[model samples]
Target chain A: MLNQLLRKLIRSASGRTQWLLAVVGLSIALLLIFAAVQVQVNYNDLLHGKTNQDSVANFLVINKLLNNQTYGNATLSAAEIDDLKKQSFTEDVGILTPSRFKASVQSYSDRFPFYTDISFESVPAQFIDVNSKDWKWDEQSAFIPMIAPNMFLDFYNFQFSFSQNLPQLTQDVVKMIVFKVNINTPNGVVSMNGRVVGFSDRITSLLVPQEFMDWANQRYSINQDTKPSRVVMRTKDPGNPQLVEYLKGHNLVTDADKTRFSKYRQIVNTVVNISWITGAVMLLFALLIFTLFIQLTVSSCKDEIELLVTLGASPKQLQRFLMKQFFPANVFIVLITLLIVTGLQYWVYSILSQQNMFVSAFTSYYTLLTALLILLVLWITNRTTIRKYVVQQQK
Target chain B: MQIRLQNVVPVPLREKILQRKSEVWNTNIVFDQGHWIKIKAPSGTGKTTFIHTLYKIRNDYSGDVWWGNQNSREVTGDALAQIRQQKLSIIFQDLRLFGELTARENIELNRVLQEPFYEGAMIDEMAEQLGVTHILRQRAGLCSYGEQQRIAIIRSLMQPFDWLLMDEPFSHLDQENTRKAAALIADECSKRKAGFILMDLDEDDHFNYFKRVEL
Candidate 1:
């Protein structure tokens, strides 16, 4: 009953228009802040998520752009490889060690006589996309295992077979045949038996095991060039414009089709930054108006407060009463803004998923945490302001 | 509660009170528990100032006013509010009521300010006894001075107190109303074994005052 009467006395001092303005301003400020956080989370999910298109884009083969100034000397030094590993975009680098000797491969059967001069490259096992049980090589092994690129089979089946009037063979037919590999030594050509074990989709080269490449190169190498000309690295975002720009500035190149999201990423970054700035400014203004409104209400009820204190109303009572009136409105505004952001996030998820791009269907935890943090700030502001003005009125 | 006044005198009337003969000014006096006391003073004798000093509402006076073992000037903030809520109740000369509230609401506010000294029906019963039942729902600001004073009297009685301080509590009422109002005040005070300090201009055969002094 006393609270009801106190409410009557204090309500006449403040109007409804100022309260409505405060609620509206606070809602807009919170909405913008939460939207900025959600945008960042969505973009991060797209870059590192295990979706179909993004996984292939995460592993890029980078090499020097073969131009007139540097055609033959396009090899990457140890320092250059280390520098690539140190960049924020690149997670790991695997050098493609090219052969320094001449080699050739010939079919075992006279029915399909195929002979070709081919260069071999070896990379660390993690970068290879194909998995097979026979992908290991040692001195005691019976036959050398080789991984051929999928593009090599495609070219032979479509162009080479049509021109040479030869029949196209399937992968199982080719895998069953053992071929003769010849390495040119100082005395004569050394022969070894080898077979195709798997087909890789990433690097376009005949890949040998790292251990075999080490032993073969030491025994039969004729040249002194040890540096690799190409490298394959796993990256978090291939479409990051900074990564592309850094590569271009250093005269390096990657697949142009993979960096297609550079312009779109730049546009998204601008929108996030703009929203952050606007939210911060609006939050400041909203806090300012709320503080001024509270001060005005207290001052308008100055006479009534004095009489109340003189009549035995404690300062704590008035402070609690005033806090009860204002803090709930702030909580309500925050909840309403959260509801709006949730609806917008669901709509955005549907639209993005329609285009074969993947993002989370629900809002991220970081955005909810940001909203809670803002509510805490508002609570502190309300508490201190009420305590300050009520204490002043008591004196 | 024992109210001790040691050399208490209003600063603005310092010279005049010292020149004339007085009993409360610059005099050591104590009003013990459960004593009904009255002070009679003529014009410009600081009757309201004396009452204000006793209530600790103004400190623009010399010397000390103590309630029990603590000095009134030393009390402040919520402690002072504690004393006011639990020990002291007042009826001012101007009949200070929340004019925007109704007559019954003005009385009910004090009734529930602390723990209730009486139940919810006490307000209506008191208003009926004081002949303010017809104006119980009327705004206190729109009521006449007699009705407002009766509301203030009932408001003061709503709280438990060791001392009930009155400064011309019945100045605007008629002779019959004053008689009836004094009877209610005396009856309420005797029921709780509490005391009162009434300061006025003239003398009257009101309640049997336990102690009378000339201010």
Candidate 2:
């Protein structure tokens, strides 16, 4: 019976049934394709959209300053610091310049008596990092722009240059050390020194100008040999957050500045809403039209059906015949529609990517799963329609 | 493949009977296989309805219709249809031949609908014996009433059905074709080991060889 049904269907497919099926099939196919195109468009837009909030950037680094602190040193030797700064591996490097200064505030009166105590001893005229463009002496006229806007004041000239330390002074005031340096790189990594400089003042612990530290150290007359605790630098591009991470992996930076970043959740949600609604709606409409068509086809053949029944057909057999007629046609249409929809989506994405509107031309798993769901729904709808028709015939 | 109709009741037009009832409104005529039983009745006296009832097409009629002693009350709708397709064939009062089919096609239709009958040679022989072989290719509607009648009878006999219910199949035929149709029907029924319930409204001499019953 199945073979017979198949032969009849093939013959009908080649005959006038083809003409009728073409119109309906094409309508359904176009509707499905339109939905698929919408899905693909929305997906590309969401994926290629502006900075997603769901994404985060992280950088991992080892603390070189902390490693040196295990030896109770607050700073590297001048030669050692120079050697390390000159290494090909360093990036966006800046030195911690320790200094001290005092400022007075009126205690809500015209005659002020109290003053804040501040102190530091040494200051590097300039800090150098081979990776940071600001410290490049080769670009003589265009030195790295100082990110600190308020380093200059009326009483102080905020200027940085290469330091030529007197060997005698370096031995006496070694205790006036800059403890820790902090670098805020674009990658969200915060590198800092592991040890604190042996100083009691709160303001000196932060990244600040050398003039402020020097005034305080001279006023206090602190004289002892000490090391700078840590040095910190910022990346050239704050948006390129990966620079700190890459530097950290090479052991050139400390681990204080590590963070994590990704945009997968945002991308996935965008895809789900965009792809599923369009495809599912198209499939739903296709199913509705298919159901209506099946009903119409069976109703139109009522006379032929009666003739077969009179020729000794049972209700069950008649139901089987109608099922056989529509099953193969449905299978063919759905498979072809799936291919067309998937292919066209890929093609449109490829075309758009060439125009720089999309980052990828590939489809996600959700698209395939959506198609499968649509097919399953169609099958279930067709079966329900068949059962309804069969019940009517029995009545 | 033997069949019997016992205690079939014929009722007024509006009276309905349930499908499973054994005894009909009121009559007894036991029919066996391989016998030509002429059911004679005046107009509107239920001759055709009785034949339909025996063939299991009239569900509202009550009776014990047995196929090889198996009560028809025990069979379901599917089983009854199966019996009609394989064990019973009917020649209607109007001939009910498909006008679109050729004479040969009409005769071959039933054979195709069921399992293959393996009696193609017999069909050709019957057509020739009934003088319809010359016009077998002609559409059945274009044939003479006598030729159409003979083809209907021959078509019904081409299958392996054990019981044949024919209702006024020769109503439009002339005297000469009527005798020929009757002879051909009796000969085919005997050869196939099938019985016939022939309903006629005429005093035809062709029904003389069969057992006669009055309703």
Candidate 3:
């Protein structure tokens, strides 16, 4: 029946009814494609919220124990690291010890949005102690200030003018960036001159590799003593709730610390919800427009319908015929819409690449959910319209 | 009329005249089956309505229209449609030839709609004998008024209908074309033994073939 209808429709192209079906079918298909993509993007953004924080949480969670005033000396020894490895749930572990130091270099004065004052007390700086000698250990150094090279150069360029020829810095700088923990001199004596590396963009406070804390104090020959403000530790089983509980039982964390962790988890849930809802809304809107397009086009041909019936066409035959004409067009329209929409999204992302635009890290479920929703909309709209008018009504 | 229509009802004023009506409020006319039945009435005297009502185009009237042995009201849409296609045909005064199609195609449309009259020879014979062969392929809307009326009559005759209902089939034709159309209809109707119920305001001597009746 459908095939016969299609043949008839092809042979009768000049009729105004055929034209309406073609146009409306194409438009609705395109709208549906756009909506599907929007939903995917919105949902994906939400899923990434939790994982993004998780990336840093593996290390950040340990700090609450070590730094809590109520629970002091919560440091883990090398033996404890070995014990963790033997646990069944353990996968891999990375222990990062970042320290800070102060140093001054000629500022290049051109990369920032605003001019800087080199005349300030210290050149804003940071230093990261990447553990491996592979040089790519710099990967672990990501989350901190010196993630990219030439960043320091860009910073100096924006803030200050370079003076005459300055001392050239060597790559050997990474190896010596950290201080020897046991090294001690007289109370007022210091060892080496401070070597500043990178600075924070959000805050004016300088960032220094944790390995350099002792070295900077001794090198500057100053008596200002300071304890580590934060100590980040990574374990193989960071997500194991039992591990967290075990650590809590060990007096490794105070009640206040547990409350803080719960608060962060709540925040993660909220961010994920926001992302899913945004995607869902975008998908719903697209589907609504798609359905409306079908309705409008179908309704436009109401005037000519009687003429069709007078031609000896059965209602079911007409619908099958319309579907044959419209279904292929709709398929083509959906594909074209997908291509155009995807291309547009790609273009937008490219433009914002420098600013990390459209970057997402999400679970697959959100995207699947959104796609299912769009399909549901199409099924409902097409079924209702086709059944109500095209498949049911007669002269 | 092999069909008999008596006390049939008229359509309502609020409705478009073309739409089929279901309720007849007034009717007081009757016709018996025959080949030369002329329905003569003044303008607005429901002459067209009488013919259309019998043809089952307007069903809303209260009346008894018998199609041979059965009540027309008892016939299904498909059955009535079959009756219109195979047993009856109509000629509008305004001549409803599809404007975009050629006169030949307009005549062919009846063949297309009726029980498959696929023989092209039939169309050729009608056009050639009616002196319209030269204009058969011209767009119907562009044909001369007399030529269009002849084509309309030819189109109605092309169908296999046993009954032909005409509404002033030669209203605007020239004297020569009028005589030609009357002769053509008379010859064809006689050969087919078909019934023709014609509605006209005045009787013309050229249509002496028809047996006239006053409304």
Candidate 4:
């Protein structure tokens, strides 16, 4: 009842259109801030979330630049490999050990006259993308198994076979054919049967099982220096700008197509930063307008307030009354902006999903938390301004 | 509460008042609790100033005014407001009611400003007895001087208080209207065992005065 009479005496701060304009400004500011937070969350989810995980984008074969300074000795030293492992981008690293012996591959079948001086490489089992059971080899096994690169097969089918006037071979047919692997030692030529077991796109080299590679190197290694010149690693995001920057700083190279997101990352960072700064400045101005409005109201009703204080109304009551009038608008702005962002998020999710991009349809918790934090700031502003003006009237 | 004055003198009226003989100026006196007091003064004798000094509205006075043992000047701000709401009530000579509000609203303002001291119907009852019921719904600014005076009297009576300060509260009313208004004031004070210091320019038998002084 007292507040009703007080309300009649002190109407909502005089300028209605200005108040509405300020409210609109506050809403737009809140929307921009919310969009920045949601965009960041979506970008992070795309980079690391399992639903959008790209298997081929997580592993990379890293090697130093083969320039004049490192042409013959491009091998990563133990310290360099350890430093790469210690970097935040590299989740796991496996060195690619090259064959240490003289070797060649020749066809054992009479129908196919295929022979080539081929070198083999071996990597740890964790780094291999194919999971064939025949990938392991021992002296008792029927034939040695090798994992061939899909690029090699594509080249043979599309260009190599047409130029050489030879028949193209599919993966299944190639896997069935056996070949003889010859390793030259001090005594004589050692021969073993070999067959293609699987195909992979992650690595380009002909890969042999680690156990077989170790045995061959132990028995027939002539050039015994086996320092690895290449390494493969698994990471959360191959497109992370930090990873690209690290690679560039260390004079290393990887496939350009996989790290293509660095450009988009930089653009998104600029956009988010611009949105954040603009929103904060606008929010500051909106709050300033509100504070000035509150001051104007209190000053305009200065006589009435003095009479009220003279009539025994405490400053706390007036402060509470002013807060009740102003804070609800802020809360309403925050809620409406949140609803708009939610709608935009769902729309973005549907549009992106049609193109095979996966992102959450709901606003992320971090965005909600940021909204709550902004609301807290608004609440404090409302409380502080009301108290200051009301107490000023008292004085 | 006991009202004590310690060499109380209004600074603006100090020079002229010191040359004259007065009972309240530069004099120490204690008006006991529940005592009806009257301060009579001719025109331009600072009657309103004395009332305002007691109410602590203007503090350009020389000496201390105490409510019980607490000095009036020391009891300030919200504490003073609290005392005005719960311990002291007043009726200014100008009838300082909010002009925008109706006469009834003017009374209701005082009633609701604190934990209400009377039921809402008491307002209508007081308005009826004071002969201002017809103008209760009229704005105080639109009402006649007599009606506004009666409205101010009822408004002052709406709050609980130990002391009621009146400065020519019935000046604009007729003899009959003044009698009715005074009867109502006296009745309300008696009901609460409260007292009042009515400062007027002339003598009148408003109530059985416990003590009377010339200002």
Candidate 5:
């Protein structure tokens, strides 16, 4: 019986054009908000170096700015390390342990022979982006696992190997080849077998495990000062502008890739923030339109509502009656908005993918969250409006 | 149940009722169960306002009205709803009917809100006695004033009540229709042993009253 009365009330009170306008406005606002949140999630994933397999570690190599003079005061001091550690963006800090002993590598193949004098450094295993069981060393081991920077291989393949007319090596092939390493210790020259375990894009140096560097430095070098000139920092947000500005202000230099990635991150953050603000403004206007629509509906139904109240209808009951008419409309609006957003997202993904960029085609979790948020707002507004109007009529 | 009215004066008609400064506005009255009472006053004498105040629908009045021990002014909204649903019912002077609904639907709306106070066939019988059975299918708004008044009377009687309040219920009805509507009301009140307070401009022979109050 109440349902019948409510239906009659809605039929008489609702203006079709006004209701359509309100729904369309709300849907557009919701669509924009959902799209913004989805884009933000995808971009955030991309900027964090997330891939299908593994994410690029948020790590940066910090060093003092170099000068023209040799032996310039470009080494990171202990005080400087403490200052970097004090930053909110810095999650963990580790120093790159420099090689104290002299080292040389030689490799011979059937078609080619290679020889080079190389510099070696090691950082804590946590700061190394490569994951390998061989990234550890012991004093009794005859072979040392090493990780070389990817850029070194790129340079070799592009410049040195091509000019020399030698065959280029893939990562798997490089990992299989062994090099004879010679270390000049205080006692004499010692030879050991070395193998490449993995490649790192974060740090540019040839890296051995910290354990091996510590032991080799103690057994070989005569110098007592073992202060490191470079530090590796793990930060929560590699793209933080404040960290970048702080580094620049202090005349500190980090890896080019780190600064480049930070710049990309800043752009992504700016886009996301702008999208969020725009979406929020649209949603606010949509809510205002919705409020006006509800006010008009209440005004049109005032007489019927007053009669119902005088006929022993409680405020809550009247609110429920009006809510029945609105709740379904809200659900329909959300569903339609989500459907439209999903289609638009696919179209956007297709456009972006054609440009050789890999962004997630859809962020289901964020989409669900957005839908839920819109529904909650609609429900609250509908209930509050009806309740307020019903209470007024009761008075 | 008994209703006690003490020193009640309608706010809008205070000066009219208290024109003589020496006159007293205070009065104590009680209507017990199964008692038929009439509140008689000409037009513009706050007759409807007095009935509304007694029904707990209007509170713009001084003093107090007590339903047994509960003050009418202090009744919570839910309590008032319950009172209207089961303890009290009213037929407004305007016959507040949903114009868009048929006469049967108007009465059914109130009938389904409460428990099964009257059987479906009983409503049909009452409609037949009140000469509204033929127009029961017609929209109440499209029906004549006299037909709508009969429908409103039937709708008000659909719910169980300890006290039924009527405001000029027979104003638009002819003598014959008024006698028939009064018979239906009296029969229902007698079945439940309920009291009724009827307000009108003049007394009539349609009901035997236990008391009369002038506002």
Candidate 6:
């Protein structure tokens, strides 16, 4: 009997204008929230360097800012290094060991007869991307393994080789080429065979083993104190705003590409923030519309509800009657929103896949969980509204 | 069930009752079980308000109303629900019927609230006796005022009530229809050995009462 009465009451109380306002507002809010979640997930992937094979780790290369007055003092001081080490984001910091000896290289291949003066810089083995065995050097070894930047080869192939009408060499071909490297140490002028082991996109300098660089620099350097001009830092979050602010405030220079990536990250963060605020506003409007609908329904049937209460009906009974009226509409709205969001997710996944971005189509389960949470909140709100109305009538 | 009102004075009627020192307004009264009573008042003297207070629907009165030993003010939610289901029933002056529902549906709401007090056929018989069986299929709002009054009377009688509180229930009914409705209520009250308080502006020969209070 109560169900019958509830059905009749619901039919009389339901208004199309209120329902349309609520549904449209809630749908917009849900869509915006879903879009925000998707954007944040993709942004996180990009920030973590998940999609690129040549992406750098959570590392940054910091160097002294060069100017006319600070050029001679550009070397990192021990005090400056200690300050960097004390940063919360800094996981590990290592100095770039500069070569203090004279080094020159001559290629043996007739296809590439080239000689150039080069400088070597060495860092910890963990920082380099090459194999440990290939990057090792000993005093008895006759050949020195070298790692050069991949950008150098790209430049030589695209600009230098194209202008000179020479055949472009692949990475495999370049690795097989041998060079005679001559180094002038304090003891004597030494000649060693050099072979390219690998190419790196992260570090820019020509890299040698730390052992070789240390031994050569100690033997050849005249100055006892040779400060480093560059530093490598492993950070917990390379995109930390505090780290960026700190670097800017100290007038330090990092890799140009890393700075560009940081800018892109900041833009993504701003977009996500704006989307969150917009979604929250939409949700607030939806809530207002929902509350308006409840108030309208309750006010329209105020006399009838009071009559029911006078006829031995409790507040809880009236709440159940109203819940039966509104609960289905709330569930339907949630279902429609979920369906639309799922379709949007699939479409976005296809678009991303077509562009060769390897992001997964499915977002985390929390999106639906959040929708369910919203539904629960709406249900609770509806119940509270009904209870308040019923209690008001009793007074 | 016995209802006790101790120095009861409704908030809105304070100036007229407490200040004027009306005899019945600030008096202690008790309506015990198995006794019919009448509260006669002039127009705008809080007749409906007094009935509402007895039904536990209004609480603005500055006094205590005890339902047996339990104060109405301190009745817990479950106890109130139980009282509404089995101990007390009311027929409002407005005959609060869902206009969208049929006449039978309004009565059936109370019938299904607890264990079946009257069989379905018995409800039809009562409707037949009250001359509303023809309009039972019609919506309560579409029915005439007299028809809606009969429906509300039948609905109140369908529930189990130790005390039936009526607020001018027969105001819209004519003599014949009012007699028919009052007979049905008295019959139900006699079967349950219950009593009722009928509030009105003037006295009528509806039932023999133990006492009458003038407000």
lDDT (10s digit) by residue, model 2, range A1-395: 32353233222222345445543654465445444545655554544356321121111212343365345543545665565456443443445555422222112223322222322222233431112333212213221122221221111222221121212212113223222332223344232221112222211232223443443344432344435544543322222334444444534444332221123434544554565566455556656666777776666555444444444455565556666776666667656666666676688778876766653354455555655665576668777897786556534
Candidate order by DockQ, highest to lowest? 1, 4, 5, 6, 2, 3
Indicate the worst ten consecutive residues by lDDT in candidate 1 chain A. Answer: A11-20
> What is candidate 3's lDDT per residue for A71-171, written digit by digit as tens?
65545566665555465644443343333233332222242122221111211122233333322212233322222234454543444324423233444
Q: List the candidate 3 regions with Cα displacement exceeding 4 Å.
A: A1-328, A335-395, B11-36, B42-44, B66-83, B182-193, B202-213
In candidate 6, how many Å is residue B155 off? 1.2
Mind giving the per-residue lDDT tens digits that candidate 5 earns over A47-96? Answer: 55344222344678888888774255677778989999999988989999
Docking class of 1: medium
Tell me, what's the RMSD of every candidate?
A: 2.8, 16.0, 15.5, 3.3, 4.7, 4.7
lDDT of 1 by residue, A281-384 (tens): 88988998898888888989888888888888878778888988888889988988998999999999999999988888888999999989999999999999
Best-performing candidate as measured by lDDT: 4
- The digit string of per-residue lDDT tens for model 3 on B6-65 reads 555564532442344322213333344545777676676667777667766567676588
Put down candidate 4 lDDT per residue, A1-395, tens digits, no spaces.
Answer: 88888887787767988898889889999999999999999999888888888898888999998899888888899998999999998999999988888889988766777778888999999999887888898989988899999999999899988987779998999998888989888999989899899999988899999999999988888877878889998998888889999988998888888899988998999999999999999999999888888888888888888888877777777787788878888899999999999999999999999988888999999989988999899989889988877777776
Task: Choose the strongest candidate by DockQ.
Answer: 1
Highest TM-score scorer = 1
Superposed by TM-score, candidate 3 places the C-alpha of residue B10 at a distance from the truth, in angstroms, of 2.1
DockQ winner, 2 or 3: 2
User: Candidate 1: where are CA atoms >4 Å away?
Assistant: A12-17, A51-53, A68-72, A165-170, A240-242, A356-358, B6-22, B25-28
User: Residue B3 deviation, candidate 4, in Å?
Assistant: 3.9
Better of 3 and 4 by DockQ: 4
Candidates in order have lDDT scores of 0.88, 0.54, 0.52, 0.89, 0.81, 0.81
Task: State the DockQ of every prediction.
Answer: 0.76, 0.13, 0.04, 0.57, 0.52, 0.42
| Stretches of candidate 2 exceeding 4 Å from the true structure | A1-304, A345-395, B1-7, B14-25, B63-77, B101-104, B119-125, B133-144, B203-210
Error of 1 at A26 (Å): 1.5
